[model samples]
Target chain A: GAGVSQSPSNKVTEKGKDVELRCDPISGHTALYWYRQSLGQGLEFLIYFQGNSAPDKSGLPSDRFSAERTGGSVSTLTIQRTQQEDSAVYLCASSLEGGAPLHFGNGTRLTVT
Target chain B: DQQVKQNSPSLSVQEGRISILNCDYTNSMFDYFLWYKKYPAEGPTFLISISSIKDKNEDGRFTVFLNKSAKHLSLHIVPSQPGDSAVYFCAATPGGYNTDKLIFGTGTRLQVFP
Candidate 1:
């Protein structure tokens, strides 16, 4: 793809519902990252994937938040039992390698009603 | 606690004037710094970056200055353009080694008026 792409640009889910956000990274990108941002807030690290494996899941906020990247291309983030606090913009970025400048997607705005 | 802070929530500058955005970090271990520009309804774009070893880096109209002792960094735009009006975020990481997750500041909204 020309740039990083994320699906479901806007999502409105009810509390306690499960929502899956998808991200498709640029071709040949070796590093993928997930970040969450609240309105007027800074980006919060969620998880990082190097290749098809994720070595740094330390940033996941809770057990309900999980992500997996397969084939080092497409990634999915699943949040079980969504809460109002989870409402924010979920951003995905990919880079050629770690420590390189990232190419970001428009992001998925999830609103837990 | 917020490791990185951009105290100024908003900054207004006239076109063709210099625009300075400041950021401060409490974590001395952060050795890599970057500035990003973001417009509404879009993702942030990399603006400029500076390594800890160097105090300043210049790229065209953008320049980043880092003060290790003060744990501060500033981004300067020469002869700011109205098109540069957007939110600017300052981010830092420990180093360019493995496991360099960025920590970003709240961001400062830069409004350049013609």
Candidate 2:
């Protein structure tokens, strides 16, 4: 791909429903990251996957938030029993390697109603 | 706590003038800082970056200044143009070979008027 690609650019789900956001990183990129941006707020780290290494999930806000990267290329972020507070933009980014500049996707705007 | 902070929510500047955006961090361990520019409905793109070892880094019309003692960093755009209007984010990563997670500041919206 020319750049990182994220699916479902906008999503409106009811509270308690489950939602999934997908990201397809650039070809051959070795690192992937997920972040959340609330209204008028900064980007909050969620999780990161580097190559075949175990992902760093320290930044996930709660147990309901989880992510998985398969084959180190495509990734999915799942939110279970979503809450109103979860309404925000979910962003995905990738870099050639850790410490490199990230290339980002436009993001999926998740609205929990 | 907000480890990274951009106190000013917005900034306006006239075309041909310099536009300065400020950011402050409380974490002294941060070793790399970066600036990103974003337009509505689009993702942020990397603008410029500076390592803690250096006080300044410049690329074309963009420059980043870091003051380690003060825990402050700023991005300056020379001769601002209307097309430069967008939300600017300041981000920092802790010292290490793995710089995956970046702490970002609340963005500053810069409006360059012609």
Candidate 3:
């Protein structure tokens, strides 16, 4: 409740309907990340969580994308079908356990129509 | 084939004058480097870091310069203000400190005029 908190900040969904983006991290900060930013482009690493285990989803770009995290402090990123280039702006970050300055969340602006 | 590159999409500093942002990486196995500062809706916010075994890294006035054999990296924001403008991202990680898959760049919109 003091940083990284993402949620339905904005979601338009429709193309195929199937979206889920949520992240809440900052409590103990054990590492959690999920990046996206289409439109102008850049920040696109797609998965990271060291507590719920995701050694590295290798930037989940396909497989319809999927992400998960649990007791380590909530995380979720699912996109089953939505297309429209899959919109963008998912972003969510957290750090501390291994540390190197990371603390973001003000994302979730998906919008696939 | 973008292995991190901020080919200057925008930059127009003035305020205090001194804002150079540039980043280029072709992945030489990277080695931890970061500089993020976004605005608009707000998200990125971590401004200095450089570690390719060290080329340069400062804080206060914000400085980060690493040119590992030309993999290049630059971020200097000496006096530039006006709230430091906005977008400016350059991140890379070959696992360092707390690496977690990062390799971004394509942001550089500093516009501190005034």
TM-score of 3: 0.34
Q: What is the interface RMSD of candidate 1, in Å?
A: 1.8
Model 2 bad stretches (over 4 Å):
B96-98
Model 1 scores a TM of: 0.96
Better of 2 and 3 by lDDT: 2
- Over the stretch B89-108, how does candidate 1's per-residue lDDT look in tens digits? 99988865344478899999
Best by DockQ: 2
Enumerate the candidates' DockQ scores in order.
0.67, 0.76, 0.31
Per-residue CA lDDT of model 3 for B1-114, tens digit only, reads 899999989999899889989899998998998999999877898878887999998989888989899999899989998998999999998888667667789898989989
Better of 1 and 2 by DockQ: 2
The 10-residue segment with the lowest total lDDT in model 3 chain A: A47-56
**Candidate closest to the true structure, highest lDDT:** 2
DockQ preference between candidates 1 and 3, better one: 1
- Give each prediction's root-mean-square deviation over alpha carbons: 1.3, 1.1, 14.6
Provide fnat values for all models in the order shown: 0.65, 0.83, 0.79
How would the candidate models be sorted by TM-score, starting from the highest? 2, 1, 3
Top of the candidates by TM-score? 2
Estimate TM-scores for all models.
0.96, 0.97, 0.34
Scored on chain A only, each candidate's TM-score is 0.95, 0.97, 0.32
B-chain TM-score of model 1: 0.96
